[model samples]
Target: MGRQSIKFKRLTPFFNRQRLEQQFSFQLTATPKAIDKRFIYSGQVTERQIHKRYGVIVSESSETDDYVLDDSFLIWQGQQGLVIITGCSHSGIDAIIRHAKKITGNDKIQAIVGGLHLRCASLAALKERKSNRSPC
Candidate 1:
C-alpha cells in the first residue's frame, strides 16, 4: 500500500476561533485580493505595504543593518515556471529566486510580487557591517 502525507493545514471558518486567537492571535481583517488555485492560493491579507511593518530587526553586526526572516509564496506554473510572492526580501531577491529554482528544479520564473528591500550603497554597507564576519 502507498502512503500519502498531507503537506499543509487548511484554515477554515469552522476552525476553533478561541484556540487560534490564543495561539496565533487571530484577527478579523480585510482582504485586498483573493485567488482560488487548488491547494495553493494568493491573497493580499494585510494593509501594510512597502517596507515590512514588523519582524525586521537590526543584527548585532551593525546598528543600522536590517534583517528579517522573509516570508515567501510559491506557486507552480505549468510552462512559465513558478510565481513567487515575497514580503520584504531581506535575503536578496536574486538569492530567493536562485533558491526557488534550486528547490523546484525549474529555471523559469513566471512572476514576482510584493516588496524587494533594495537599499543604497551606504545602507548596504551599514547593514552588512558586522562585528564578527564569517567567510563563506
Candidate 2:
C-alpha cells in the first residue's frame, strides 16, 4: 500500500452586513439525559465596555436530557424587538422566544428561521414560534 495525500477544500467567511449591534452564538454539545429544558433571559446588554453585553438568553440544558443547546442567538435591528434564532432546537424554541421577549420587552418578532428539529412534531412542537412570516 502506498501513502496518499489528503486534499481539503478551503472555506470562506460568510457575508454579513456591517452593523453596530451586539451579536453572538452559543452552542452546548454534551449532557446527560434526564433534565428538562430551562430559559435564561439576561436582557439586552448594549454596553460597549464590559464583555457581558449581549441581547439574548438561552436554555442551559443538562446532559441527562439527551438534549443540547444547538445554536441560539438574538437578532436585534435597532428599534425593533428581539427576534431569537435557533438551530435544531432540542431545547424548546418557544421557551427561548418567550425569554427573549420578557428580557427585551420587544413584543414584535421580526422573523424566525432555521431548523425546527421536531422530526414531525407538527403543532405541539412549534406552536410558540412566530410562524411562516418569512420574507425568504
Candidate 3:
C-alpha cells in the first residue's frame, strides 16, 4: 500500500456582516446573567501564577505578560448543587470556582465539566495543586 496526499480548500471565506447582524441580537452587560439567575458568568478572573503563560496578544502590537483576565466559566445551579462548566480555564480553575461561589453565594459544587487544560503540567506543579485544597 502507498500513502496519498490530500489538499483541501475553504468554500466560505467571507461573511455577510450586515445580514448576520440584522438576524441576530445580543445584549452586552458588565454582569452577565441568565435563566432567572440560575446560570451566570464568572466575570473577571484572578489566578495564581503557578501555571501562568505570558505573551498573549491583545492587538497587533499590544501584548500581555499575564494569564488571561477575561476567561470565564458558566455556573449552573442544579438540583443537587452548582455545575461549573469551563472552556480552557485559562484564568485558573481555583479562581473560577471561587468566583462562582462568591457571585452565586453557593458553595456546593455538584460537578465540574470541560477543559482543565492541565495536560502539560509538571510533577511539582501537580504537587502544588494537590496541596491547595479545592474550593468545591
Best-matching candidate per lDDT: 3
**Residue-level lDDT tens digits of model 2 in 72-107:** 444453345444555544345555555456555566
lDDT measured at residue 23 in model 2 versus the true structure, 0 to 100: 60
**Which has the better lDDT: candidate 1, or candidate 2?**
1
Candidate 3 stretches with Cα past 4 Å from truth are: 1-20, 46-54, 58-66, 122-135
What pairs collide in candidate 2? 31-63, 32-63, 32-64, 32-65, 33-63, 33-64, 33-65, 33-66, 34-64, 34-65
Q: Compared with the true structure, what per-residue lDDT tens digits does model 1 show for residues 106-131?
A: 67767766776444547666456322
lDDT of 1 at 50: 33
lDDT by residue (tens digit), candidate 3, 1-136: 3333333454765545666678787554445466465787666655443355543445456545555656777888988889999998876777777777888888888888899877898989988876674545
Note the residue pairs that clash in candidate 3: none
Off by over 4 Å in 2: 1-66, 69-71, 78-80, 123-136
TM-score (C-alpha, index-matched) for candidate 1: 0.39
**Cα deviation of 10, candidate 1, in Å:** 28
TM-scores for every candidate against the unseen true structure: 0.39, 0.37, 0.66
Ranking by TM-score, best first? 3, 1, 2
Candidate 1's clash total is 1
